[model samples]
Target: MALPPRQSCVDHEEISLGEIKIKTKDPACMCEVEVAPQHCSVDIKSVVIPIYLKFVDVRCSIRFKTSTLCRGSSNIVGKEILHGVSGAVGPGQILAMMGPSGSGKTTLLSLLAGRSQTNLHSGSITYNDMGYTKALKRRMGFVTQDDVLFMHLTVKETLRYAALLRLPKKLSRQEKIQRADSIILELGLDKCKDTIIGGPFERGVSGGERKRVCIGQEILIDPSIIFLDEPTSGLDSTTALRILQLLHGLAQAGRTVITTIHQPSSRLYHMFDNLLLLSNGHAIFFGRGQDALPYFSSIGLNASLLMNPADFLLDLANGNISDTSIPPELEIKLIQSKGDSKVGKPPELAVQEYLVECFSSEVAFRDSSVDSPPHAKDVILPPRREWSIGWWQQFLVLMSRGFKERRHEYLSWLRVFQVLVSAVVAGLVWLHSSADSEKHLQDQVGLIFFISIYWAYFPIFVAIYTFPQERAMIAKERASDMYRLSSYFMSRTLGDLPLNLVLPLVFLLITYFMAHLKLTVGAFLLTVLSLFLIVIAAEGLGLFIGAVMMDTKHATTLASILLLIFMLTGGFFTHGLASFVKWIKYVSYTFYAFRLLIKVQYSRSQVYDCLSATGCKSIASARVMADVDLNEAGPMEDVFALLLMVVGYRILAYVALKRMNTAR
Candidate 1:
């Protein structure tokens, strides 16, 4: 095997402007090649496929619907956010979008990254001068503003799963693992590779390492274009500088890197190849980073030599020119532009309008020395493969990940202790109740009702928090085209089933034997089966509620109201309900479960002692069940009803997740 030419062997042109040195790579030798260590030999392709991203006349506006009470109708009010912003970034360069908060930096980045835009937006965003296609989705990567990761997954585990799911299926599993190991080495994450990525409560990797892990996940596929939203946010100056250097290295490897930056230090500003300055959703300047200072000075806005260039640019965008030394002509130009916008606007608004006009009027800036981007018809895109893995493969991988991440939470000592303590207390309260007398029979009824309601209550609350807690993580993964939504949904559902059953099964075993509900094997199995069905049905309903609400507090509130209603109509609390509410029992799965338990324990031929106005007499169990309305449904009928609920609620939850994915 032959190694590619080294970086020193490639021809390069250097230009000096003031204190900044700009290095331009030769177009004929643009491909980037990497040499591996002695033990490992995989290398980046010698010929790179480049992506040129260009957007023209981009505009975005949001509509706010305001109600007019007097007219009994609503009016649509529109506010323009991004106004005709335009720029272009090509291979082997970093384009940095900089502005203060709410200046449309993140919004423009989202649009370019192909995220969902619910508002009215118009723009021509092209790659290689071509429109977006589904194939392009997997070819690009997006890192969100916030780090979305499994808190329990070690750094190596996170990257390994990403490699398994994102890498091409043609590669063997061992090869994919090796790729992950290489990324860990490249990112200098070897020290903390085994450490878990912790959250608010747990101690884990530092902030810089977490951000690097997020980047590693995206780059696992070697994306042609990568979009990052505030990747340097919440980090110290030194760490942020290192991150910028890493991005620069990626650009040098022939990847198109575009990122949103809020406020950068002086040292960080010079690292950018191109800069897009925005204010109030309007572009103030679009040109090379080094040329910005010269362009501003030419327009008679001069900054102090000691002042940070980033701060100076930010002040100009913010319409704060108190520290800036403006020439007489520029001051006059600001006054002349006052009447072009609103009549009685503030001085700051006037200055911003003047700057917007200044950039728009610069023809030389619009037609720089850069060559025109190639047309789509002239460029040949590589053949894109289908999803790296099949649906079942995705399900298995996701299931494995979910189990590894959630086992600790599911089998925690606190939860185990809680279940055990509750089981013991309930068993002692109704210990060894015989079915011979009416009082004992009533005690048995209470035990059966407790089994039905207690099991339902435990899982419903727990599962309601599932989707709400993982909404961000799910969205992030789905956006990356890592796997189908169905794969994730199924894996999430099945991964939890076994772990979720442990405590419940233990609770039932302890209570059933201690309370002496049934001695026969068939009866014991039936009781356990009934509780399992109840758990599945209840968990499905909880998932549905969480998916619909996607907020912890709201989902919990709705689940509480819904479960309370179901329990009330579960054939135990109320018998003489109004006709309108009588039909609720048919829909409440808990009602079916309770009926199944009653049928399992008490047979139709069983008799109980009763007393009414005379000596004690015998009463048939069938008559008692009839009075309570539990005898209407057969045991098999109850099982089918519960099974139907288990399927129906799960379907609803999945549909909800699909809608959310589509919305994004």
Candidate 2:
């Protein structure tokens, strides 16, 4: 007998006369595994991944920590949420986790991704392969339930940046592009790869395209297991079927594909060979789909032949064991019987003994029961050298997105234009006035305080307006481990620069010219410098408040309260009244700086240019109490205070952000 033709590195095997060769491809791990068991063959020309998932355990949670405020609502009590549960998944087989809407099905997905941990009291999510689940996030890929996109970047750029941030340099230029192309086509995003993904603010790709792009990013890394929250959700029936077919393709090619889906159509249900039914955070049925009837029958429910067994299983799944539909005793007996089979034997026991025996020879995937690597640490973080793409790349991408987001709007310089108009008007009106009107002196004090308080609202708006929308995206991405919190903070701090710089510069140029009391070249420069510090303080304050508050309403209310405090203790409005709250002024950035700027610009009779906002003579008669020259208002006194405000608030915001952002 002749031997089979072999093109691979390994030697050939003796062949039957009518043998058929089949091939399959993997774009992420970048390899192919062939089989000749049947007439059909899948000859994979290329793949991106050479590795596959050894094991995967994802746990999604909705933490209801109900202390006092949220305790009464049945919705949020100590629901134990997705009760103590476990499932095993590897390559090739589809573990279709089926359940009702509130059965914690989605929560299980989130938990497996390790996105939520607080509401979850005790559990261990271990990925035997790829090594790190927490610190080394590059190893896992998560496709969230929503369509999140930048709206500015096209599908190609979106995947490109994600790959740049994830793939190592060793993955050559050609390799990266090839992998990206593979993922692009793999998800059927070829047509819309150049299209922009849309958001409410900007228009681009459709929902299905957006979801594919999100998945494309994870595929770029060649993760061991790919997790989808609900890939078929909201999609049309045809599109939904296609999405599942894509997942089916991935599983067949030897990549672990785990997804949480609601009740699917008969066509969709038939696609799944394995089933995991969850009810009330518990797994009631887990085994082959065909075995469902036998499994239920063993528990005393003889489901009629030709009946849609899923319906009976689901109907019984309703926790209504007390109802006659499923007598309480029978329900308890059924549940107890099922629960008893959950352990001792490995999860693979659910499959027939013969299938287990044949798995070793028939299965093409890397084993899921792989043990921990000898050098592995519990904390899974990448080495420092892996930054061919990472925070630095994302920082640049976010900053670019921020710029584009602003550019399409009425220019960021619009505020500057408004200030310039105000400056021209103020220069024309107050061309001459630097005299002894005590009433004028009092008016200036009120104006300064009002500006201090009013500008306080700007940073809050910047933080809240920008952050709330991003809150949803951040949570979604963080759950997938796409980027870290530190990177977002750093990017945001840098990204916010244009607005901060532009807004304050305009306000200062206008206000200084309008209030021309006295001016020196040194005083002019120092005033601009002082204005910058105030803006920095405000930005930090806004981020801090935004990070702690979940809702914009609460953030706005808190911001208003803080603004009142900044104005009162700022030494501009209530210097005398501050006697009761004097200590507040010491900690208030506005107080020290407001006092400093006024003293510097209004202390003496100094000559001024008409172009200067605060004109030729210092109103000496207002208060001769302090002869401290306008040029020498003593900045050292508040310099430390300004630094403290900036440094203190930023550190606080970053810390708060760390606790809040669990998406990455």
Candidate 3:
């Protein structure tokens, strides 16, 4: 006889039958103990800093300015979302907040997580009796409803990078990798460890697996409190249960977990240690999961055995209650209150108000218990430390991660094809033209101007997507204090540099030789140098645009307008313009870049012969340059101007990012 097939690595049992030939770790038993993280110097007692969270009368309101055409005036409108909601949960407890759509579940969660920017009318949110601080961020982990992940990175790569940037410097790289592997095994992700975390566009891990990856990343640093906004929002029942089960394990390990859930099955519902039922931004019930039904029953609301308690609660919250469940007193009160102004409210609002009153009157005392002083052991505040990795280390790690995440987008077949096509077309259009001819020399200048404008146009569109696409992920990581903004900004700029240069370099190599514009090494090198500056300067402008307007659509529009303006004043289109706008040419990066290109290829000594009225008269390069106004500035002057744009735009971008972070 053979032993039953092993189910999971953590929990299993031996079969009744005599096992076939197999040697277990302990030849007598067939079960394996759960694997622990392999991070160095990790003492569970010291690391598991349990957080006892409590919030009192947490209320949030938002204000917006509106214009009224009738009055022809502006008005300030305020709407209260979360109205005096309160709850508490301690270590080793799973507090599940359930409510229907627009019931303020997420709003409450955001306020508790300290991520909300709305006005708090009155509330006190504390952990271990201490207020939220920057240091506390390191001890908390937040998993938003949507899985924000690098779609191209494998599970192992994603988790390992999280560990590398998030884990303490005390842990070696190998130890960090081992820790990631441990989490992979613990979360039962070993099978898909090498699979890419897919997005809507790609096929890879399943939804359950992706959620587990998010959990794994948050837990890599052993956060004391984990806040999840509907971790199981969009998954199937089985997959959702698996995520909750994983979260249950975290609670069992003495970590506090709070999550917002929409609806759960009986089995999933029972797993919650504490339940917070909300309806219309009001707290209806806050107590043990088992006590919720009892409390509802005691309040004259009962569900049939065949009905799910969650369903019944939702029905009550939704004002879909049956006549049998309506208590005589509530019904009588409803009748007597009909003449009252409150009767004009929606049925759900009335019902929600009734539940709020019932819960508050009977169990308002429970809030006192949650507000009681916490134990001294729970007062531990994680020691605030600088970046777990040094500044340079963070830059390297971020750059490496950025490179891996974006390599596919940068080197996609379509992009390579586009570059190749553009190069081939340009090469064929000006194939083997003689430099001594005036017409060919003029064509070469036009070609140089085309190069400048093409590089500028292409890079701006490409760079606009960078910040917008990663905004959510960056916000999440920054909220957790994973890395500095400077490190991330530098890494993004530098990591893109090498790959961004690839297409331009390849284009120049192919187009320069085919066009036969200049044969000298110095001329070719200068051509490359000037084109490279244009690319860099354009990229910096794109970064600035992306940072300023973290909306890809808006950024693209603004970039188009700005680039068009630069092209018009680029000195190639027109030499004369209005005084007010003529200064734009001096400031336009493309203008300088175009000037440098012309300066590098043509010199005062060079002359081109053209068949004219005087029969093959020689025209000096100086006169040719004067025709287009390229001779106004020397090569060094244009280089200096481009250098300034290159550095200045990036600085502005960095500042914009910093301001955006602060705004958040």
Residue-wise lDDT of candidate 1 within 1-664, one digit each (tens)? 2233334422343322211122324333223334333221113322344678888888998889999889989989999999999898988899999987899999899889878555489978888767776667766888888999999999999999999998877678898999899999999999999999999999999999999999999888888789999999999999999889999998898889999998898889999999999999999988889988998888888875569899999999998888888878667756766655756666677678778888888732342234434332343443452576889989999999999999988888999999999999998998887776767777788899998999888998999999889888887887777888899999999889898778888998989999988799999988888888889999999999998998889999998888889899887766777899989888998888888888888765555663444545433343336534334445888889999999999999998988885423
TM-score of every candidate relative to the true structure: 0.89, 0.71, 0.90
How do all the candidates rank in terms of lDDT, highest first?
1, 3, 2
Q: What is the C-alpha RMSD, rounded to one decimal, of candidate 2?
A: 9.9
Ranking by TM-score: 3, 1, 2
Tens digit of lDDT per residue, candidate 2, span 147-178?
A: 66677777887776666556565566566677
lDDT of 3 by residue, 203-253 (tens): 999999999999999999888899999998889999998999999999988
Would you list the C-alpha lDDT of every candidate in the order shown?
0.81, 0.59, 0.80
Question: TM-score of the candidate numbered 1?
Answer: 0.89
Candidate 1 segments exceeding 4 Å error: 1-48, 68-73, 329-342, 363-369, 372-379, 382-385, 610-624, 627-634, 661-664
Prediction 3 TM-score vs. true: 0.90
- Deviating ranges (above 4 Å) for candidate 2: 1-79, 82-86, 116-136, 151-153, 171-182, 190-195, 290-313, 319-398, 405-450, 464-469, 475-484, 507-526, 607-636, 661-664
* Candidate 2 total steric clashes: 40
Candidate 1 vs candidate 2, TM-score winner: 1
